[model samples]
Target: MNEVYFPYFDPDFDKLPERINGPTCRVCIDNESMDDCTVVKVDSVNKQGLLLEVVQVLTDLNLIISKSYISSDAVWFMDVFHVKDEHGNKLTDQKVINYIKQAIGTTRETHNSAKAKTYANMVFSPEPNNNNEHTVIEMSGTDRPGLFSELSAALADLHCNVVEAHAWSHNDRLACIAYISDQSTHTPIEDPNRLASIEDHLTTVLRATITPTPTTNQPNQQEAKTADFLGGEGAVTNVERRLHQLMHSVRDFEGPPSRTASLPTTPSDSESDEEAGMKTTVKIESCDEKGYSIVNINCKDRPRLMFDTVCTLTDMQYVIFHASINSDGGYAFQEYFIRHLDGCAMSTECEKERVIKCLEAAIERRVCEGVRLELCADNRVGLLSDITRVLRENGLTVVRADVETQGEKAINAFYVRDMSGNKVDMEFIESMKKEMGPIALQVKNDTIRPSSPERSRFSLSHMLKASGSLITLLLSSNPCKYS
Candidate 1:
């Protein structure tokens, strides 16, 4: 008999045997048949995180996906994505295609997985004077899993409206360009302070890092510290084991796949209408098993919706062990198996109600409100600080921000509101545009700073204020990112 080992009990346990063998995943790119775009097709065994993993690889390659079709039977999955390079041309490189195939074909071991290291570099700038009324944001960085999704969530958090976007990846580098507008004004952003906030926030997101805390103590404290660490670790392990047992119990109760084969072949009339409208709905219910809850969500599909939902759950301090997601024809259906972050189940009525209300609010906030704007210009140190100062002087509030820099050029987006919590009017927007015109021109021209006494004093003060403001903004904006 084959020996089965659990990683929770033995940290050095070997992973379970692979279910599929002999090159189960396949990928191919067709450029000749598709006139303006490239068609990339993938076939692989069905498994958790399979779709997300494939997307991460494509995003790293700097390939823009214009359209995608995803289908999965119980045993196998197939996907076809219509794509293009940043320049909107079909892919011509064979080596790049092979790299994608290899990435998707390889099977990942489940245990002792290590996080990939990523380095982020960015630029911030303002769009050039043109008849077009939108600003542009661009970004390039080392690609990692969920990079695109994190970018989308950052943009949504900033209240920036995405007017148009293009993204591509080659090897380990990913690049993206987006044309956006202020959510309040529905025009290009002119307030410098708001732009600065957007740049700083996005830069922080791109360069975010996680480091494990080291345990150190004096002689008197060593014993206590060691005991505490071991106790906490043991508690976590027990909770995880219990959660896994509960999942298995529920699945067993549901019976084998063949048991559902005798069910109805088609949905009723009412069910069809509900699915057709594609209205957003969130449902939370207690699992019959102890220490678990089931979260069911049905909604209109949009970019990064999955990431947004997952982010919200994490913010609410929930641990998710199992999740299934399906999106088809602009509608998304998702189910999550969850418990409190501390491993306790939702046993109280009030807890369940709070979960429902909070989730609904999170979804509603993203879908509604805010004006979007975009900025493109040459990036410089302290540029974000200068821009944010201007916005504060004008009494504008930043609702959302997304910033990206590639080489020396910077492109950014911000969704903002006025002091009164309302969309900005045209007159205010025009005034901002006039004030920002000279700044953009100077940055583009690389004008030398005047060396007068007054100029030196102003520069010193500006640096101090920038440092303080950056710290304050990071601490206050979107606590969920840190949590």
Candidate 2:
């Protein structure tokens, strides 16, 4: 009889002891295979703290988490750790299955991330002229920890050169297109069987597709770098470098780049534009579920432009806070709130309107800038039922919904709307609230107060005329005078 030796994780192992002290540990149970790494979905009421704790736990386990993606739905963390099998072979495994179950019980948490959010409605096609010079893989599913890196590692093991890749996560579902070519040998990965095997391996670990030949080489290198970073060394720094270049491209607001829609050929009169620049706030209210709602403000020099920019937040229902007019005669500042009653879906009209509005305000165009959107809400039965009624009566569609709460306060955020611009009445808002009670209050200036009934009319009407959903929260004006 032959005896086999195996290496297991030391329960008391302490490398980064500070990371896994006490309740702050991300421990995975019952996973030993390299290909079948498990993902534990931890949805503690304390999501943020729980996420931090999980990170610490992985660190304590001496595992290297490649990416920790946070979005409106849930926190997705991807990691890799060196593990020794019975044969003493170092291997990489995705610890997603049982690990998630061990931490959060058997209940499967929703898979939503900025990367793989667009799981549905995405069309993948094979890149033409593939006479064996390239291999394309369009993989998208729930964004899990190490999905990309593990795939890249598998590719590396097979000695493939990644030529192009693009990926984005909306609600933790990831969609990615990767183009690969055989190592310097440049061997054509043209075998259908080979392609199927690759896809099978990817599906096993990533739970994503491995399609052959898709879309011409409109390769977004930034996405490739992101995938690389999530997969291994020097990727994060490289991504940071590119981000720095993008930042330098814009002259102001070293913050993330703002979305700018193409300017209309028939521009408004110069004098009128200047007047639009003078207005400090553009309050927009639209009918959602209850009365109406407000979105965000674009503080660029043009108030009208900010108004148009409201189309971008079409996904969420919110109320307008204020869009500060900039002194530069361009779009300067913008703010808005996601409302409880506004419809749950957005229209193309809203998207275009917001884009045009932002352009009017003076936001410059750039490549690969951060997309700004917000969803803040805790789960509350009373608030949701109220908002739901308004949405149904108006025939507004809900594209996305998430309820997240921090501290003791609850925030309910929804993206919805009437795409065809159906008329939503005030009676509907009133009736909905009467049945479900008052809409939840938004916290402002560190003080929280319920929205008044009259205010709902103003808030809702303003939201109806709006284009984008208001995701950016307006920081309360400082009442503290400077010394």
Candidate 3:
């Protein structure tokens, strides 16, 4: 069997192996699959962000959370997410579990089969309710970006009052504790048809499976806890009874549309008849201090278009920091983190705006004419070879080079300056731009050419090295290279 599929094997084939098992849900025992995984102690403080991050990952993977809980601060919040094949059988495949563990940030720790299973089962136990006051919905799964925002928006539109909400992330998985009450209970949720419609909508919005807890005959601590979890139901009677019964059913909320109709066409997708553009990444080193901000204006992805982003620090205004940029087709993407010196207050408001304007102008200058073309391609070993050969063969001296890769494509920019410190001929640049356009190429000449020897000597070797390394990383990946 392929290594990634080894974990799905059923051991012993006797009693139904415990539906769940593992120490912390993040620690997966499977070396192959991440089909159904768990994360542990997610309810603790300082771990909430981790849960959101995990949810973001799961949303990306198309997996859904099945069970979750929020323990008191002293207790760890345990969460479980399941992976099912097309046939609907639980898949314990090691490969799927490992992918999930990595996706949810849990693979770093030791795996405990029994503990993971126990925690999953604990949350998955049927939640039964006989009364009707509030509903407790527990969500858990791999984390992904925009998952929370979408869920919150749907709930707001549904008129469901979210009285209590606690979210946590541990091991890259996300779990949320939500106590929802129908404020317009005048038309209570007693009607089955109404309940089913709302339930189905919730499933679509969350992109995860949903289950209901069964209401018990006798009142129990869990019921009171559920009521308290819903923040006392406010002047409503029988809150406990209502919460108990509502908890029985589980509802999955799917994510946003895979491809929204409203999404703007990216530069890479534009036709050749569209405008041309140049994309570049800039690195700045400055002290982290008060009153610094980065901003961009009219920057969009396109051939010959301006791709701009900024980095400024407010706490340590005078602290030193560095930044860099990268591009895809005609679009530019940037990643920069700032740090502050000891005991520095954030930058003041005025200083923040100044930094933003500076970075924005710095980038806009190159693309002022507009982007003529843009494309995305993988970064291959021969990328630099092709660039330099083209420049040298065309008699264009490459005074400096800045290169970056997004997905498979290598973005290269040649700051060509003649030996006399004058800029390369505009006609030559235009010709080169035209030739490179078919292969996702761009060219920019700073209107004011650099004449000083210092300008010519400063090679972007370090920046290129950093960007190049990322392209060389060859792990098991889907390699979605978006321009």
Candidate 4:
């Protein structure tokens, strides 16, 4: 009569109203349990990507997830997250808590009634239209040192200004989203001819030398093409989420390295273990009794790491059944129990390996290896172009970039290295600060870790072809559950 389950969720979850007929969400916040962080518990009817949606709500608000637990199986689901503000203190702001409820704790009768879309069905149609004040440009292709600079220059020449932009590169694949407007009128370009022209120019830049021979009709062999979806800025699709989709569309996890090889050379086992030491360790195994594939990961802690991992799993069509997240001693330890959307555990060795490859690629995509620079200046029509041109001319390569606008000011962050993949010269960086004005351009993370900068290099193709497997050990034991 006293028996108890070790990893407990909500025992009364089955009795919640509308548990069987519709999606119901109940989110509770407890601030007294932990002094350093607030504990958030969410119980709801399960759906595909439900975990990702919850995580996205918290991450978008810039809250830090210190630890958490997740369980979603059969008809019900429950998740607990220990969270803190950016200052590492438990959340105390009432306004932020209310917003989190509005965002993640709403019932979804509509979602319960509608069928979920498959990966193929989710691709944005390439049709061009004038639907918003700015034009949305989506692209994916092989990344090069100055590809962004080239694209910015081309757009500038076409009388378009990039007002907001995000670019991500992984495994030599580049995924970019830019909201552009007319340079002169500062509005969406409506002329059919101009839109056509812009698409053509971007396709050329993306395809340059990577286009396949004229004989292939296969979708997998198709070169990168511009997909124009004119829309308001971040109104419908989450821009960052779409970036993940774009990279997966191009099959970045399996493709060969591009000519320029955005990632540095993979180190040989004999070269040094330092580079491998920094790798995000991943292991996947199946629990047949529970019908779930458990994934365990250990890695150096970083911002948004959980979001990136969960995003990959969701995009890969895996549903999380249970999870535990913790961070200590500057390292992250996470375990996820998941299964395919159809409710089957992964069965094949190949399947497990693919999951590992995809997870590793996902984790490394956001890890930049060079000096991070932040630029703040008054917004201008061709501001992005000017900044990118400066980087290109200075022999620097932007591995990652985040561009946004606030009020009348332009705020941009760039992760840059030399044309060759190595630590940047401080003297050159100082010169750049002087050129761009010291107060306007500041070095945020100037001290790049030199011990194993190559660990930041991630090209799935290179990782496989070089050593034939990932650097992480594959453990067979399940990670211990959080108390």
Candidate 4 global TM-score: 0.77
Predictions: Cα RMSD each: 19.2, 23.5, 28.8, 13.8
**If scored against the real structure, what TM-score would every candidate get?**
0.40, 0.23, 0.22, 0.77
- Cα lDDT, all candidates: 0.47, 0.33, 0.34, 0.68
Question: Where in model 2 is the C-alpha error above 4 Å?
Answer: 1-133, 169-171, 208-483
lDDT of 3 by residue, 126-218 (tens): 222322454655544433333433444555566654443333222222344455556465223345565465555655655543223356342
Give the 10-residue window scoring lowest on summed lDDT in candidate 3.
112-121
The parts of candidate 3 lying over 4 Å away from their true place are 1-101, 104-350, 358-387, 395-482
Per residue, candidate 4 scores C-alpha lDDT tens digits across 149-171 of 88888888888878877788767
Q: lDDT, candidate 3, residue 115?
A: 15
Say which candidate scores most in lDDT: 4
Ranking by TM-score: 4, 1, 2, 3
Clashes of 2: 103
**Which prediction has more favorable TM-score, 1 or 4?**
4
What lDDT tens digits, residue by residue, belong to model 2 across residues 314-408?
21223222222222333344444333323243344565344334333222211111111123333222323333344444444332332323333
Off by over 4 Å in 1: 1-20, 24-280, 285-294, 310-368, 434-483
